[model samples]
Target chain A: MSLAKRIIPCLDCDNGRVVKGVKFVDIRDAGDPVEISKRYCEQGADEITFLDITASTEDRGTTIHTVEAIASEVFIPLTVGGGIRTLQDIRDMLNAGADKVGINTSAVLNPEFVREAAERFGAQCIVVAIDAKCVSGPGEPKRWEIFTHGGRKPTGLDAIAWAQKMTAYGAGEILLTSMDRDGTKNGFDLDLTRAISDAVAVPVIASGGVGNLQHLVDGIKIGKADAVLAASIFHFGEYTIPQAKAFMREQGIEVR
Target chain B: MTHLAVIDYGMGNLHSVAKALEHVARRADLTFKISVSADPKVLQAADRLVFPGVGAMRDCMGEIRRLGIDEILREQIQHKPVLAICVGMQALMERSEENGGVECIGLFRGEVRRFAAGQHDAKGELLKVPHMGWSEVKQRAHPLWRGIPEGSRFYFVHSYYVQPHDSAEVVGVTDYPAPFCAALARDNIFAVQFHPEKSQDSGLQLLQNFLTWSGHA
Candidate 1:
């Protein structure tokens, strides 16, 4: 059972165009979401995630259209999040061709929403997106807190504990993002990623800190993440999905 | 035109499957027509049928009975070629242990069993359930496997594995740390636990073969 490590290129879309930023700020235009996603699929991306960064009520319709356009062309598994606050939004995303829905803010606000969504749809379709940042300082032991609203608000909940709760609540997968490493091009927070990966039984997709192919390999090899989701590098054409996959294959890591 | 229908019982993402079939058909330049419908008449008229499902076994079986899809599948399986994927394949068993226990269509003598808790690979590390990723499926010489190579990887996302009563009914096997049925074939019926639509190149080839198959060995 060689389950290939998945390489997912995340599209931070707002309105209709793909955007990129550092720690969920300084958003810049990348390209059309559909075109970029289609390119990634051709490049052997295992999956694609489209997050509607601008989660306004008015812009919700446009995001659905973009998800539809992308899914109509791209055959890979598509997960959509941002502004997905209710079961109806989840149903809309699935109807828009999303195979999974990532819930961050909503899941934190109403934990039972996760269980309800999973029961109504399926556990395979529910993805809990966790944006965490290390709060541990000098004398304090290691601790990470969950952040919501693009990392602007702290939930006072420990990231690891929340992940365990989310899993028990029926979240089939976890999209763990380190707010500090996001868009830094440094590397994934291997410690935090591994912590959550070890804490949960479901698949963990490490996101928010990839600069090169080696980082992609480390996300799985070191952090023990089941998948890696990256932006910027793939969006700007610095490295294609195939290039990263080749790097993983050379690293002796299975990728599809 | 060669008409194909993918059975839609409100349990799966049929759009992607339909799109993949259309893409493969266009690439192969075959005169194929495909649609995702729950109507029995549309399914009866098609040259081929695909039964695709996801979600819990209990809900899937509930919907199958609520819509009379069980009768449709049972009657059609005898004469026409049918393909099932994921939970669609699990529902083909006599019963599933999921949701405590759920009775299924009973088209075959097999029970869907959940992966024992705390499953691990050779490394002594625990393996996750829902087995969500691509795994190399070991083929067992079947007509539907026509052009697909041996040990080709296909996308799989499931927790329960089907245990067929007859070994010959198994057409392919994959290990989630242990060997289990990955693909099955019986007469005009061909079903896989993986999502060929999401699997890429080799997956498209398998779909192409199904389109051309004559429901005979």
Candidate 2:
């Protein structure tokens, strides 16, 4: 109730410029992160989330220049994630004007980091992102399984239960992403999103599989998500924020 | 120029609101500029001020105090058009139950309380918490909603709603359990529980009215 219906456009960056494609390929130079962020701000993006897709175990520093550049140019909130392992990384991101920090691989490997981040910088500043794929089965773990390292490795953990643990560890929000639906433009994994939302008390942002405005409405109305996150649809100029909200309004979903 | 100053103090959703205002101004053939900043000088030069929010009311008020915009808002509301949307509107109330308790801008004598619908209304009872969907705003006479139709739907994503001390200030009402105030206005001050920016035509027209009234058209 305290949170608004967020329309977040994620910028997946390798170095500085935005990139696209499944598993990060085609290597399209969308635009400068700062410039693209400014455009999104003008186009009505509630928040900007930058996933340093390249910042992995090998890479040490995040695209600090990109973060600083975009942070200096916009006024809305920004959340920086990817390769965030240590407290120093979180500190650097916050000092760079990031309102929130998202944890993926590290949090999955060491769940205590979530609790540490929450304790140091209020739980509101910490976001735990989960990339999950539905496992095919019945009594033998028929639930969604966690995928880490940008969907390169499967953690073999039930996503529903992991999300509950993350919340318990003091994650302010959950960025629940569907690896199966990601980059497919099919639709959000409503079943996956709802399962996670129903399990947590914090806000849940539904990511992946947003092809049209109806996808967003479905995410909010049926999925019961606090926000919806998409990439290519907003990046390729498929839908403007106003247009999406207008559509949601017609569909009876609370937006903005 | 109809310059709109979108107050910013580490709060999200200002850009989205500004974009909607900018789009409305363009459609209305009005020359308007929307700037997002916490600098006091920008506020001083603004013709209109819009406070947009998407977070806790307590935290928002804390940021407003941190930025020292509370007094500026009071002074500006007396002279120029001020629109408070979503949590922005909630911040205009006397208090809220967001984090146990918090005091807000006393622009209107009201308290924001969470929706208490235990059971689903469709299931022969009140609906659950976190009222999330489009609901009609029973429109009344207000400059901000001049051309918006009666029972026009606007996007609403909030669990708490305002109950104004003076019923006259309630310009729009919508039903959930009982009738609730969806929009409020008194003089230059305007507030809405629903997000007009996200309401499509009805929302666009409302923004157009604000732009036009601010002398942008």
Clashes of each: 0, 2
Candidate 2, after superposition: displacement of residue B44 in Å?
4.8
Candidate 2 per-residue lDDT over residues B1-217, each given as its tens digit? 7788888765545444666677677767887788888888898888888887765666678888989988888888877888888778888889987768889988899898877635344424235345544566787777677777777766666767898899999988987666888988888878888777656567778877877675211
Model 1 TM-score is 0.96
Which candidate leads in DockQ?
A: 1
Per-residue accuracy of model 1 over B122-145 as CA lDDT, tens digit each: 766668877888899999988888
lDDT of candidates 1 onward, in order: 0.87, 0.78
Model 1 misplaced stretches (Cα beyond 4 Å): A56-62
Instruction: State residue A31's C-alpha deviation in candidate 2, in Å.
Output: 10
lDDT of 1 by residue, A1-256 (tens): 4788899999998768899988788988999988898888888888899888778333343378888788788877888988888878887787677888999888988999999998877788899999999999978878999998888888899999999999999899999999999999999999999999999999999998899999999999889999999999998889988888898999988776
Runs in model 2 with CA error above 4 Å? Answer: A1-128, A134-143, A153-157, A165-175, A180-194, A197-256, B10-12, B18-23, B26-45, B116-136, B149-159, B174-180, B197-202, B214-217
Residue pairs clashing, model 1: none
* TM-scores for all predictions: 0.96, 0.65
Docking class of 1: medium
